[model samples]
Target: MQLNPEKDTELSQKVNRETARLPWSELMRHFASGNVVWIADELDLVDVAVRIAHDDKASVGQWMAAGQIAKVSDAQARDWLETDTSLWACVVSPFILVQQQKIRH
Candidate 1:
């Protein structure tokens, strides 16, 4: 299937705009419902959200296999609660993809 670069770009920009920094506390309900996916810090949270939105199965599968992305675990949720971690989050329906906010110098 052919991809439209313009459409893809627009989607990426839209997702990027929707991404925000949120405290873990604010996401507890979603976590409890198992609708939160943890993104590796090395990955771009917005890019992951866009891929999921586009239904890029191959890329999503690879990330899942590599453990770069997965549902938030109980242990992780507890840790985040303890530390009050702030995350970069973007929603792609059924799931909210999140990553540790990058520390800016």
Candidate 2:
């Protein structure tokens, strides 16, 4: 089977858009339940803003204090991320654990 380049690009863009539009509340729940994951690439940096209320610094700050989400440094991500190594962030924990996307259909 052959893949259409245009379709692939369109789908990729769509996924990214979806990620950025994720609601902050949902992200908080992900942190609370340990169901969060992300890629460690430059694009991952943009991925952080995908959370719903990411635009509201106040709300984000509150979530950070409550341990719902967190932003880690590059030095910190270097510890485990060796493959596509890039940006690093976290969901409630001090460590960053990015998972590769392999479930997309």
Candidate 3:
């Protein structure tokens, strides 16, 4: 059954149920081509980071601090849609995690 985000609780510290998920393969393709992906997935920021980058969850936080990854709002994602770096993804939450490299080693 499809998850009803409307009936769920907030995803995490900064994310909420308003988030959504996108297919991963297409996401990877877009990222591989050097495009920015605005992720609206409702996930632990760490997990999302880990999923998208070589760094583990802990390292993901560091990446965030280092500006390797970023979190954006739905509005920002929407605004970005028209930009060159406008690729997007959402796995379950409202957090938008982005990195400038490959997720796998």
Candidate 4:
């Protein structure tokens, strides 16, 4: 399938506009349904969402292999719940990709 750059850019913008900072508690149900993916702070949440939306398996697989992304684990969930963490999240269909909010200082 040929990828249209213009379409991809538009999709990225849409995903960026849809992204938000959501409380972990609010996302518990999605996590429970095993539909939450934790994205590392080192990566751009919107970029990840765009890649997932495009089904760019090679990029996603490389990120996963490098420990830059993964299914939210029980331990991480517990930590987030305990801390009342708010994460930057973007939905890519069946999955909600989240990243820890970057610290300014």
User: What TM-scores do the predictions have?
Assistant: 0.92, 0.30, 0.31, 0.92
Task: Estimate, for each residue in 1-105, the C-alpha lDDT of model 3 and write its tens digit.
Answer: 233344332233223232334434335444444454443333344346334433245655665566545544455444444453423333332233443222322
Candidate 2 worst ten-residue window by lDDT: 95-104
Per-residue alpha-carbon lDDT of candidate 2 for residues 10-100, written as tens digits (9 for 90 to 100): 6455544443233333344344554454433422332333332234466445555665444433443344334433323333233223332
Q: Cα miss at 63, model 3 (Å)?
A: 0.4
**Predicted candidate 4 versus true structure: per-residue lDDT over 10-82, tens digit per residue:** 9978988888999999999999999999998878888788788889899999999999999999999999999
lDDT by residue (tens digit), candidate 1, 1-105? 356889888988898888889999999999999999998987777778778888889989999999998999999999999999998888899998889963222
Off by over 4 Å in 1: 102-105
Q: What is the C-alpha lDDT of each candidate?
A: 0.87, 0.39, 0.40, 0.89
Residue pair clashes in candidate 3 = 21-90, 22-90, 41-90, 41-91, 41-93, 42-92, 42-93
RMSD, each candidate, Å? 2.4, 14.2, 12.3, 2.7
